[model samples]
Target: MAVTLTEAAARHVARYLGRRGKGVGVRLGVKTTGCSGLAYKLEYADEAAPEDVVFEEHGVKVLVDPKSLPYLDGTQLDFVREGLNEGFKFHNPREKDRCGCGESFRV
Candidate 1:
């Protein structure tokens, strides 16, 4: 079970961290919300919790809590640009369905 970030994502995150100047890494998790019952949660982590799992890829650290591991395992995160919009995208193999608005997922 693991989570990783693409090179582009790493660069993007690193840039953000550099600008913020106070973050150790990024945290990825799930929360109950949205039309599909679950939505992705992301935040800048200044420190790692004892129960957190960390994965380093492309020189960036990705943090995840134990409770979110099962739902996020084997997920590869990518930074993408579509027309004038750009953001992080999750490539989760365990996702069975995504809400119509693309804000949440169910597995």
Candidate 2:
């Protein structure tokens, strides 16, 4: 089981890390909230903790906590631009459905 970033997402993360000058990579996890019971959380990580499940792709490290791994396995992150809005999106093969607002997912 693994989580990965798409080519566009990798490039975006690498450039941002370069600008920030400190982050080792991005951290991805799931939180218990939102209508569907789980929401994706992401942040720039300066270092990996001892227990982080790390996946490196295109020089960008994506870290996941063990507890969040089951829900996020086989997920691919992508950076997208739609009209004037741009952001990161997740493609999770395990997701059965998400909330109508797209804020949470159900396994």
Candidate 3:
């Protein structure tokens, strides 16, 4: 039960943190919305909450709330560049299906 980041994601996050100068790591979570019932939520974390679960890889940290753990376990996040578009993508083995718009998923 862990959430990890790909090397590209780690490097991108590390570089961004270096530029921001104040974050401790990135936070990963889930929200209730969309047709599939859950949406991934991610943001740069300035600090970890008392109950946050933390995973570190490639010298980068990813924080997850307990409530989001079950949904996010075994998930790997990656930073990708396709043509002129670049963004973070999630690879979750537990996902059963996602909406047609790809905005959400269900495990």
Q: Pick the candidate with the highest lDDT.
A: 3
Q: What are the candidates' C-alpha RMSDs?
A: 0.7, 0.6, 0.5
lDDT of 3 by residue, 1-107 (tens): 89999999999999999999989999999999999999999999999999999999999999999999999999999999999999999999999999999999999
Better of 2 and 3 by lDDT: 3
Worst 10 residues of 3 by lDDT: 19-28
User: Which run of 10 residues does model 1 get worst, by summed lDDT?
Assistant: 35-44
Candidate no. 3 TM-score = 0.98
Give the CA lDDT, 0 to 100, for residue 52 in model 2. 99
Judged by whole-model lDDT over C-alpha atoms, candidate 3 comes out at 0.97
Off-target runs (Cα >4 Å) in candidate 3 are none
What are the per-residue Cα lDDT tens digits for candidate 2 across 1-107?
89999999999999999999999999999999999999999999999999999999887999999999999999999999999999999999999989999999999
Ranking by TM-score: 3, 2, 1
| Candidate 2 residue-wise lDDT at 93 | 98
Clash count list over all predictions = 0, 0, 0
C-alpha lDDT score of every prediction, in listed order: 0.94, 0.96, 0.97
| lDDT tens digits by residue: candidate 1, 1-107 | 89999999999999999999988889999999988888999988999898899999988899999999899999999999999999999999999999999999998
